[model samples]
Each structure stands twice: as C-alpha cells, then as structure tokens.
Target: MTVGSTPPKTLYQALFNKRMLICICTGFSSGLPLYLLIQFIPAWLRSFDVDLSTIGLINLVLFPYTWKFIWSPLVDRFVPPFLGRRRGWMLITQLGLLLAIASLALYDPTTNLTKIIWTVAIIAFLSATQDIVIDAARREILPDDELGAGNGFYAQAYRIASFVPGSLGLILVGFYPWSVAHLSIAAFMLVGIVTTLLMSESSKPSEVPHTLKSAVIDPFKEFFDRDGWQSAVWILLFIIFYKLGDSMATALETPFFLDMGFSTVEVGTVAKISKTIGATVGTILGGVVMIKLGINKSLWIFGVFQIVSILGYVALSIVGYNYLMLAVASGFEYFGVGLGSVALIAFMAKSTSRLFTATQFALLSSLAAVPRTFISAGTGYIIEAVGYTQFFLICFACAIPGMLMLFKIAPWNSQKTAVEETIAE
Candidate 1:
C-alpha cells in the first residue's frame, strides 16, 4: 500500500490488535515510575512541609531523564541473559523501579531529605532507562502506517497510568501510613513484569550495532547524514521546545493545587479526575484525527490547542479556589497536552531508523525532556517572583517558538516522505 492511500483496517481493528495491546502494557509500565516521581513524591514532600523552592529543586533529580541518551548505547548493544534485548532491558529496569519506589517508604521527608532525594533520583534513572527500551520496542513492532494510532494508544495508557501515583496514591496516603502507600504503589510494577514475560520480542534489525562504539556513534552519524546538519539541528530544537510551555506550566502541578488552597482530596478527586478524562478523550480523539489528517497537520492543529490550554491555568490563577474552575482548567490543559503529546511521539517514532531504534529514540526523547528537568527546576523561583498568572503567560509564550519552527521542520502541507520511503522498502 502507498502512503497516500487509506489504511485497509478500520479504527476498531487497528486498535484491537495485539500490537496496540502491547503498546498499552508498555506504556503503562513506562509511565508509572515517572509519575510517581513528578506527582506522588512532590505531594509527599509538600505534606511534610517542604518549601516550594526545595520541592522545585527536587526536580533536578530528574536530570537522568534528560541524560538517558548517554547510556542508551549500552542498552542497544548488550542483551541481558534472560529476555531478548528489548524485553531484557525492560525487565531489568522494571525490577529496579519496583525496588526503588518501595525504598521511598524507608525515609521521612523531613528528617531524611537527603535519602529521599537519592532514592527518587534512582527511580528517575530506572524510569528513564525503562522508557528507552519501551520506546524502541514499540517503534519496532509498529509499522509506519500504525504509528499514529499506536502511539495514541501508548500515550493514552501513559496518561491512565498517572492515576495510580498521581491520584490514587494521594488518596491512599490519607488512609494509610506513607510507607504502606508507597509499598502499595510499588506493587503495580508487577503489571510491567507480567507484560514483559508474556510479550514476544520485537523483530530485530537485520544488521545490529556490532560494538558499543558503533551503537553510540552510528545513530548520531546516520541522523545527521540523513537530514544534513542544518535540518537535523532544527529537528532537535523542535524536540526540545515543542512541549516546553505545557511542561513548565505543570512542573509543580501538585504543589500548584495545594498553594491554591485545594486539599489533597480535592486535587486527587476533582482535578485529577477531570484531567484524566480530558487527556483520555483527547488522546483517543487525536489518534483518530491523525488517521485522517496525517501527523504534520495534526501537529499544527494540536499545537494551537496546546498553546491555548495554558490560558486555563492563567484563568484558574485569576479565579482562585473554585472547584468548577479547577476542573475546567485542569481538564482543558491536559486535553491539549494529550493532543500535542500524541503527535510529537508519533513524530519521534517516525524519525528513527529501525536499526538504531533504541539509541535514536532515546536521543530525541531525552532532548524533549530537557525542559521538564532543567527549566522546570526554576519554576518555583519564577512562581515566587512573578506569581501564577504571569508565570503561566510566560509558559504560553515559551510554546510559540516551537510552533514557528514547525514551519521549517513540519510544515502543514509537507509530504510524509519518511514513511513513504519505509513503505517502498
């Protein structure tokens, strides 16, 4: 089939396939520990009276996410003794995450702040490593045509996984000791373990990267050689800035709700529920829309939605303390996040060579994560300096450069040359 022609499968058939189911499992596994770091841990710190600046500084621990590309070559080059390359790494990291998450219960944030930070850092490292394997595996299994719906389902499952540490963990802490809550959340890693055991390894590339040096050097060499240095630089910049605005806006999300005088229950039940519903509907809708519109147009349209959604946070800042407004704002913002993230992920997956899937996707995604880790660390300072209303406006402004770059890298009328080439092959 040509790239210009409609896919033979219906949406239902596309979504119900084994590949999509695997996407769901891998997505859930990939998302859980990260949310536990970004959502649950921050809330835990705040509850123990950790100041905003300190809590914000904790985002620095997530530096591993931004740097995971450095070690991705190891994952790409070496297979563990048990499962094949991808699933082997997945099993190892998932197991490490389970242990690291549960270890968070061993310290009190007040007295053992150093210990907590180190443990959270370890979780972030494991989570980042796990994401490398999962992204490569998903890319290998999904064909070019299926990238949109496949990544949509993956992104959906990713957002759904947030409900565990983001929403349910918050509520659980209300009834149980922090230790019990931490352990309970840790148990969820079993889902990934089971999925890893049952799922077949994705088809390997015909030619593997024979040495660690080749794994490290060749992905970069191929990407630059393929696009030329100038276009490749533009693509990397877009990867960094595309989601910058929304990412900064939500950097201290749990803390933002608390600062706005919402109780943990209110944040957990109302705000999270609304956000999850909006994200779920938006991702599913975005996936379907991509099937019709193609990824380039979807990026243009969804980029607008993402930019506009930051205004909801500004509105909440203006109104203050109203549950209806909170729900509306949170839901709207994440709905846009869902739309933008789905397209971006599909774009990243499309950008990689299957032979260098793990290393290339890791480099692309790690660049994508730079804002969330480095720039977001300053958000607490920004919030204190400018207050919520202006901070969000700045965030809204941060998104504009990325949209403009789309003109260069992902122009609205551009052909899907990469996917067409893959189809020809």
Candidate 2:
C-alpha cells in the first residue's frame, strides 16, 4: 500500500466496531470534568463580576494537568484494590470527580474564593488522573490499523461532551442559581460511571511493570533508547509546541466572548449550535480523510486549517459585538481545532510503546498541556497589556515553530511505519 492509497474497508466496516465504541466512551469520560473546569468555571466566575486578572490567576489551579505525569507511574505500578488495572482507576477517579464537582456548588465563588480555588484544584487533579487511565486504555485496546479513525472518533466524543457543560450548563446558569447549574453538570458524570462498569479492562498484570522502580524508570529509558536521544528530543519538542499557540489563544475564550460584549445567552447559544455542529463534522471528516491521507499528510493539511483558525480569533476581535461574526469565527475555530486534534492524537497513539503506554502517553500529554496550564496563566496580563487584537496576532506568529518542526518530525512524504503503509493501500 502506498501512503496516499485508501484501505479496502467500507465506511460501515470502519465506523461500526467494538474498538471504536470504546473510543467513544473514553472520549466522553475524559472530556466532561475537564470542560467543567476550563469552560464552566471561568464563565461562572466571570459572571460574579470577578476581575479579569483574578479569573486569569484562577487558571493556576489547573496546574495539576501539567504535572500529571509525575503520578502516572503509580497508576502503572499498582492496580486498584477493586477492578482490574485500568477499570479500577477509571472507576475511582470518576466517582471522585462526581463528588468534587457536586461539592463545588456548596461554596460561593464570591464569598469563598479561597475554598473555590482549592476545591477546583482537587477536581483538576482527579480529572487529570482519569485522563491518564483513559488514554492508556484507549491505546491498548485499539488496533494499530484503527489508530487514526479511532482517535478521530475519540476527539469527536470529547468535543460532544463539552456541549453538556459549555452549552447546557451555561444555559442553566442564566435561569437557575450557579449551585443548581453545577449540580446539574455534576450529574452527567454518571455516564462515565456507567461506562466504567460496562467496559472491560485493557491492561493485564503481566503486561505492565511489576516493580515501582521499573515502572518509573523503564518507560523513560525505553523511549530515549528506541531512537537516538536527538530524535527523541525533537519528538518531545514537537509535542510541546504543536498545540501551544492554540491552547493559549482559547484559554480565556468564554471570558473573552463576554468581554467582547456578548450576553451569556448569546455565547451559550452560539457555542451550542456552532461549535457543536462544526466540530462534529470536522472530526468525522478528519478521521475519514486520515484513512487515505495518513497521519503525516493529515498533520500538514490540518496545520493549514489550524493556522487559519487563529485568524478567526483575530477577525472576531476586530468585528466586536456582532453575533454573526462571532458565530462564523467560533465555528471555523472549532472545526479547525477538531481536525488538528485528530491528527495530533493519532500521532501520540502511534508513538507510544505498548509496554509503557500509560506512562509515556501521560508524559507526552502532560507536556502538551504545559502551555494551557502554565503559559496560559499570563494570558490575562497579555490581553490587559496589549489588548485582544494584538494578543491574537501574537498567537498566530507563535504557531509557526510547531509547523516548522513537522519538517523533521513528520515530513510530508514520510510513511512512518509498515502499519501505515499497509493501511494506505
């Protein structure tokens, strides 16, 4: 099979498989709590007349995401006391997230800012932990041939989960008290709990590291050993910079819309319709195209859309207060993001060795999140200093380094593995 050739599988055969269904569950289970923290909480705080600087500093509470790799070895080292390795941790974290999210409503963000910060931090921690197990499970269960399509479905499911909080939760806030809205959002974690109970565990005791030292040290050693240290470094840098610009640009998106003089109803309605539909279509299209385009070409094609999407933000900043412009810009942004995410996720899945699936995926994903967690903390100051228009232009420029790295990491004509080469026929 050539890199540009399509596989012989029918569309029905591609979409209707056991592994793909698992990908959907993984995506939904992993995305919900994250959307709550990143989307719902910021809007909730901003609605209470919180200053932009304080709201920006509140992002610091999400630092757990960037450091999740530190504790991932423990997950790899020890199985849960109850369920098997992956399922056990999935159940534990899902339950913890439910309790944490429900409890968030008890403290008023206005009067209990400190409590809110601490509580939300715990939610972020649990959410990050859940992501590690889910990502590992997805990697283990999916066949190599299904990586691109499976990850595309996974990204789509993740985006769909966001509609629950980003759309429904936001709408509820306008009518009900914030507490009611929060509990409503928390109830949705039931989906993840049900999924955990129903799905089979992916990891067996023999497959993972038996000792803590082996769990902690072997994944790192194996990664650096597979290729020369130089190539490994380039791969790590590519992961870090690829999503950096996009993450920072959208870090304060909900707040940015509100600041642009859009009403909550307007933002919520627009996001519900535009982002949901656009991202869904883009994700499916990205996945299907990836079957023929291969990950390398998909990255190049999607990178163009990703760069163009940043300009949508720049357009929104210029147009100011027009809902029509808001809809167009946000819709394009979501579509581009969804396509780019499919490619990046497939690449990550391809990169990991099965023996170190949990640890290595966690490490890579955690590095990818650094811009969102740490660098994004300063976004409020940047917007305050340079204003929205200039901030977006700066983000567009920042995206170039990652695209440049693609020349070395995933060249346009490169067929990375025999699996990809065969699948392309």
Candidate 3:
C-alpha cells in the first residue's frame, strides 16, 4: 500500500482521546530507563570519584540505545500470546528495564564496575527495544491529521523523562549517598512498569506492511525515493551534532557547578526544578505552536532557538554564580531543547513508512542521540585540559559544521517539496 493522508483531527479529539493519552504515557515510558543507563549514571559514578574517562567508557553500554534499528524488525514482525503485538513487546521490555535498573541499584560502580556496566547494558538494550514499539505505535495510531498534535503530547511526556530522570536523579544523588541514589534510580523505573501495564496498544495499524519484504524493503526504498543519500547525510549529521556544543557543555555541568562553588544541593535544586519547569512548559508550547504555525515553519524557528540555547552555557561561563543568569540560562536552554527536540522528532515520525516505522524511527531517533554520545565520549578529556570557558567555546564551534552542511544533508528544497506534496495529497 502507498502512503496516504487523512484530514487533521479536531483539537478536542486530539487532546481527549484515550488512545492518544495512552500513546503519550507510553512515550514517556520509553525514555525513563534511558537516563539511568546514560545520563544520570555518569554523574552518580563521578560522585564516587570515578575517573572521567571511566564514566565516558561506561557510556558505551548505551550503543544499543543508539543502534537498535538493526533489530526493531523482530519486535514488529513477532507477537506474544495473551497480549497483542506491540503491547506484548512493551510489557516484556518494560519488565526487563525494571529488572536491569533494580539490579543496577544493587551494584557498586566503584567496586563492581563490570557488573554495573553489564546490568546497565541490558537496561539500555531493553529500553531501546521498548522505544521501537512505542514510537511506531505513536506514529501509526494517530490519524494523519493528528500526527503533529499526537507528537506534541508524546513530546510533553518524553521530555518529562528527560527532565525528571536526569535532573531529579542528580538531586537524589546529592541528597543521599551512592547506595541510596541507586535505589532511588530503581524506584524511578517503576514509572515505566506502571505505564506499560496500564496503557493499551492502539488498534492494529491498517497500514502496517503485512509481509517480510514490504516491511523490510519498502521503507528504505521510499526513504531514498523521497531524499537521496545527501538528505540522509544532512539528517544524520544533524542527529549527530545539532546539540554537540550544548551537550558537551551539558556533560560538564555537575563539575562546573561544583567548581564554581555551588553546593550539590544548589545545583540539584536549580537544575532539577528549573529544567522540569522549563521543559514542561516548552514542550506544551512547542506542540501548540507547531499546530498553529505549521510543522515546516516551526522547524526552522525551533532549530534557530536550539542553536541559540547554547548561548545559555556561554552565558553561564561569562557570568558565574549569578542566580538570575543561572535561572534564565538554565530555563531557556532546557525549554528551547524541549521545544526544538519535539519538532525534530515529529518531523522524523512523519517520514516513516508504515512497514518501516520502527526501523526508520530507530535510525532517526538513534541519530538524535549521536550528539550526546559524541559529547559524552570525550567529555572527560575536554574537561580535564580546557577550563569550562574555553571548552564551551570549542563546543559551540561544533554547531558550525552541522548547520553549514544543512543544505547538503536535508536541503530546504526537499523539506519544501515534501510539505507541498503532503498538502496536495
């Protein structure tokens, strides 16, 4: 079957539907364990005085999170008994996430690095698999008219994970010692457990490709048909570095705050509360604006704001210990990230073919995390040699290569044609 478009759903329906709410909740679930496996884990380890490179190396456990597209097909094509396809996979993977994270709480990163890494690797893998199912369901279940709104709702939930897990986890680590923080991290995974058990999958997708080859071959064929290797290159580059500067700056946040004479309590309180508040507001605002202004226009606007948010870090470096600067910069950056990220995600969600939803979304979304991976990988070395000021400047420069290459990678021309075609269809 070919791609088809339906008229947009009403505002009321988009906001209130049971399936839509479930889709949004599960989207949050998909990201919950990821913080433990990637973001918060490093900070926790760092608290124990674990070497920075070790923290960076532990990040490799998350390769699965960034590469799960290779195996999303198995989940899409297979099913479990009692529960339907997506639901069953979601249930099983959520259980795995719960177990892995709980076990992580039990291991001592200093004394048991190997065991800790193994458990985290398992959790990251399961989390990525859950992403495959949940992302496909969110994209497919919504009517064509509602993809943007649905994406908005889903964005709200997903960024909540981004905020709550990382920022709050830091606070948890600050308030308690390492052992207690691990347990708190485990308890946080319960959010996913509750969400998966409570939420039902959407109706079996009418457009889901029925056979192996269609699901296997059609998505790639259609993707290339729409935009060639150059478009793919642009998207891939953006995914890998759109936020490289910000992310590089982000990786050193806890250290920088500590160096600047802020107490753990201060960093935890400001980063946690500010990020949660900003991202929540930013997500809802982004979604609403996407609907009103239209997705295509919103992308450019949101993207510029994303780039600008890096200035917040630059702001922090320039004005140290000023709470006002801290608050504005923290809030604005988190908000911009939340708003911009949803636009990027919704755009990716729209591009997937039914047969290849999981694979394509996995590829694009995985690419989304590539920036974090690159930043996390070398954050240790950067922080060690260069002070925060110079490091942030270097990080800021990484944006240039990607932004300059945007035309070659995802040219405005293709985005324009794609929008026009959608409107015509």
Best by TM-score: 1
Q: lDDT (0-100) at residue 406 of candidate 3?
A: 48
Measured by lDDT, the strongest candidate is: 1
User: What tens-digit string does per-residue lDDT give for candidate 1 at 118-230?
Assistant: 99899999999999889888888887777777777788888999999988888888788889889989999999999999999884644457787798998889877775687
RMSD of 1: 3.1
Regions of model 1 farther than 4 Å from truth: 1-13, 203-207, 416-425
- Ranking by lDDT, best first? 1, 2, 3
lDDT of each: 0.88, 0.84, 0.69
Give every collision pair in model 2: none
Q: Count the backbone clashes (under 3 Å) in each candidate.
A: 0, 0, 2
Which digits, one per residue and each the tens of the lDDT, describe model 3 over residues 115-205? 8888877887888888888887776677777776677777677767765556666676666765665666666666666766776666375
Better of 1 and 2 by TM-score: 1
lDDT of 2: 0.84
| Deviation (Å) of 252 in candidate 2 | 0.5
Model 2 over residues 138-168: C-alpha lDDT tens digits? 8888776666667777888889899878888
